[model samples]
Target: MEIHFTKMNGAGNDFVVIDNRSGIYDDLTKEQIERLCDRHRGVGADGMLAIEQPVEGSSSQYRFRYYNADGGEAEMCGNGARCFARFARNLTTEFEDEISFDTIAGPLVATFPGEDVCIDMSDPFDIESDIELSLSGTPQTVHFMNTGVPHVVLPVADVTAVDIVAVGRELRFHEHFAPAGTNANIHHVIENGHIRLRTYERGVEGETLACGTGVVANALVHHQLTGAASPIAVDVQGGDTLKVEFEKDADGNYRNVKLIGPADFVFDGTISI
Candidate 1:
């Protein structure tokens, strides 16, 4: 089969996006997807995004399906969602400034403002703070949250000083979060409402240039720790900054969470599989 796809990136985390609404690419296997994401052998991306028909009874314009480089389906991906919105808009005339899509996480609404795309993220839950873990015989302090996906955020003194792969891998498969592992992140607060972060993503199984949900996870954890306000600026390894905004209710629940960042088109091509 020859598949037509668009290559896109949000911040620096990239993807291979296909319009699957026609059901043309429905039979793509996990192995095939893994090959497609292979850096040297295939299209080379952090993951893949499929724009499919919305489920029955869903009012969304389309359905969003995300696959990690390993070809495993994920609940959500913040950066990928932004790129999905842009890719979907350009493919059809039915959408303009705003678009809505359904994902494993839930229905998400997105808007395009100039060159950036902003997504209304699902409300986060299952928050745990100051959890102590023993890594390499050293006690580490981390926070946990479910921002569409499970994540563990470690506030480090210097993000660059940490061994992302080694430490992140350890935390990713730690028995503390067994079975369904968690993405691991090490972040440093740059200022009152700004932070620098490096993440070892779960399905990607290694470090990527950026991660959308990881960014939001760290931002919210920062707010929880220091009482920082909304609209936190996060500097990712990709050399781009993403902004996260959320409102805290009187009961300390986070709502209206939004992720704003750049979604750029890299290229488009047809590949044989």
Candidate 2:
């Protein structure tokens, strides 16, 4: 089969996006997806996004499906959602300034303000602070949260000095978050509401330019640790800056979380599979 696809990126975290609304690509196998995302052999990307028709009775404009570079389906992807929004807006006439879509995590709304795409993310849960874990045979304190997916944030003195892949891999598979595992991130607070971050994505199984959920995870963790205000600016490894905004509820939980960043169109092409 020949597939027409668009390439997009959010803060340098790239993806291969396709319109699967008619279900033409429904039978796409995991191997095929992996091949599509192979940097050496295919249209290199951090993950894949599919724009599908929303489920019956749902009010969303569409459904978002994400597959990691390893070809595993995930609950949600913050960057992918932004790219999906822009892709959908460019492809469909139904969308104007904003659009809503459904995912395994829940429904999400995306808006375009200037060149940036802002996503109203779902409420975060399962937060744990000051957890001690052994990393490289040394005890370390880390924070955990589920922003659509599980993430472990380690505050480091210098993000550039850490062996992200090596330490992140250990943290990703750590027994504390075993079975499902989790994404790993190391961040250094630049100031009260700004930080530099690097992430080891779970399904990608390596360091990428950036990880959307990982950015939000780090931002919220920073707030919990330092009482930083909303609208945190995060400098990602991709050389791009993304913003995360959230409000603390009466219960001290995070709500109205938003991930804002650029979703750019790289190119469009057709390839036979």
Candidate 3:
């Protein structure tokens, strides 16, 4: 198949954006998606996105379907959504200030505020216990939460000192949580007000340049621990700053969590797979 796609990035987390609104593409096998995501031999992306017709009874114009580098489907991705919004804007000749799309996570609102893409991420879910995982022969205590998707956050002393590739894989395949695994995020509090971080996404299964939902998960955990204010800034390894904001209800549950970051088009091309 000949695939025409736009390469986009959000804070260095990249993806291949394909417009399948006309239903030209059909079900893609996992091997095909994985081959396309191969850095050296393929298009080289964290994942692939298909902008398709909205689901039944959906109010939005389109829905974003995301597949990881491994060709596995994911419910939602913060960075991928930003790139999807930006790519959609570039595709349309009509000028639109704001846009909305549906995903497995439900309705999403994206605003093209000047040059950046800001998204109204749905409320986080599954805030649960903190546990210890054996990684690289060391037992590390980690916090698990789902900010749109499940994430395991581990507070590290030095962000770069941890071997994310090895440890992340271990935790991603841990027997305790088998079949469907979770993303691994390691973060360090830069100061009382900021966080520095890296993440091993489940589908991508590597340290991405930046992760949108990972930032939100870490920020929420930080807020819970320190009682910080809204709009927390996170410095990701990709050298971009992601702004996170949320509301904590009287019961201390998170609501209205959002992620704001940079999304830009890198290039466009066609490839045969």
lDDT of each: 0.95, 0.94, 0.85
Q: Mind giving the per-residue lDDT tens digits that candidate 1 earns over 127-227? A: 99999999989998999999999999999999888899999999999999999999999999999999999999998899999999999999999999988
Please give the ranking of all candidate structures by lDDT, highest first, separated by commas. 1, 2, 3
User: What TM-score, over all chains together, does every model reach?
Assistant: 0.99, 0.99, 0.95
lDDT of 2 by residue, 6-71 (tens): 989898999999999999999999988998899988898999999999999999999999999999
- In candidate 3, stretches whose alpha carbon ends up further than 4 angstroms from where it belongs are 93-95
Clashes (N, CA, C under 3 Å) per candidate: 0, 0, 0
Quote model 1's TM-score.
0.99
Q: Give lDDT tens digits, candidate 3, residues 1-273.
A: 888888888999989888899888776678887888889888899999899988989888679999989898899999999988887877685638777899988899888777778899988888865687677677878788887788888888998898988878887788756778888888888887699988988888788999888999999888877777998999998999999988988987888877899998888898898
- Clash pairs, model 1 backbone: none
Q: Tell me how far candidate 3 lies from the true structure as C-alpha RMSD in angstroms.
A: 1.6
Better of 2 and 3 by TM-score: 2
Which candidate has the highest lDDT of all? 1
lDDT minimum window of 10 residues, candidate 1: 88-97
